[model samples]
Target: MPRTDTASRVITAPLDRVWDALVDPAALAVWLPPAGMTGRFERFDARPGGSYRLVLTYADASGAPGKATADSDIVEARFVDIVPGVRVVQAVDFVSDDPANAGTMTMTWQVTAVAAGTRVDIVATDVPDGITAEDHAEGLASSLANLAAHTER
Candidate 1:
């Protein structure tokens, strides 16, 4: 079966707050990066057909990151769909020299209102062969945790 890594969590924030984090570049910059990495948007246009660029760099000098040996990862992404307060879909391509990592991937973020809070779901499809599923999942989880911590305060 084709690889699709998925994760879900219930955030204490409301749907609007969660949605704001998805669309607001400033909020995203705070929580989108994984544990040790940090993210900054090169260019972000949230509308459909708009393209975005993000650079994820290591927080520490150590080269090994879970499963890959790279100081950073740069992705060129396009917004496929955006439903405010509901869903977002992005088509992304990583800039890499390796043949295994040269491919387009899709990432979907969904937000649903739950009893306790908002349920956030992320699904990544067509993940690069250079990145293992476990690593990707960890990164996603870390981002979610960051988001949770960010809005909670």
Candidate 2:
């Protein structure tokens, strides 16, 4: 069966600023990759039905080979829904030949106003079996920290 994973954080920034970081491609390129990864967007369009291709490269490739390549994970994603300042939903698939990584995952990013700032919540569903829960959790938390840093500045 497919799995779902979630992570959330309270960013000490206004909701609008946080929302802007979510939509901005440049900001995403800086914040979307996890701790040991660097990412670049090949193409990006942030409207409903639009799509983007993101390539993430591992800083160290001594472990298992990446989903797409020896050191890279390529994601092809489509914007499924965009609710300005509230939420963004995407349908994502990894560009890989491995059967374990072949599937469409739905990722939802939601922000809510909180007492200290904005609470950003991310939920990923139908995660491919190749991605372990522990790794996904760490990646999500790392991305959230990156997002907080990007928007708080």
On TM-score, the leading prediction is 2
Worst 10 residues of 1 by lDDT: 61-70
When summed lDDT is taken over every stretch of 10 residues in candidate 2, the lowest stretch is: 60-69
Q: In model 2, which regions exceed 4 Å deviation?
A: none
Pairs of residues at least 3 apart in sequence or in different chains that clash in candidate 1: none
Give every collision pair in model 2: none
Candidate 1, number of clashes: 0
lDDT string for model 2 (1-153, tens) is 799999999999999999999999999999999998999999999999999999999999787578999999999999999999999999999999999999999999999999999999999999999999999999999999999989886
Off by over 4 Å in 1: 65-70
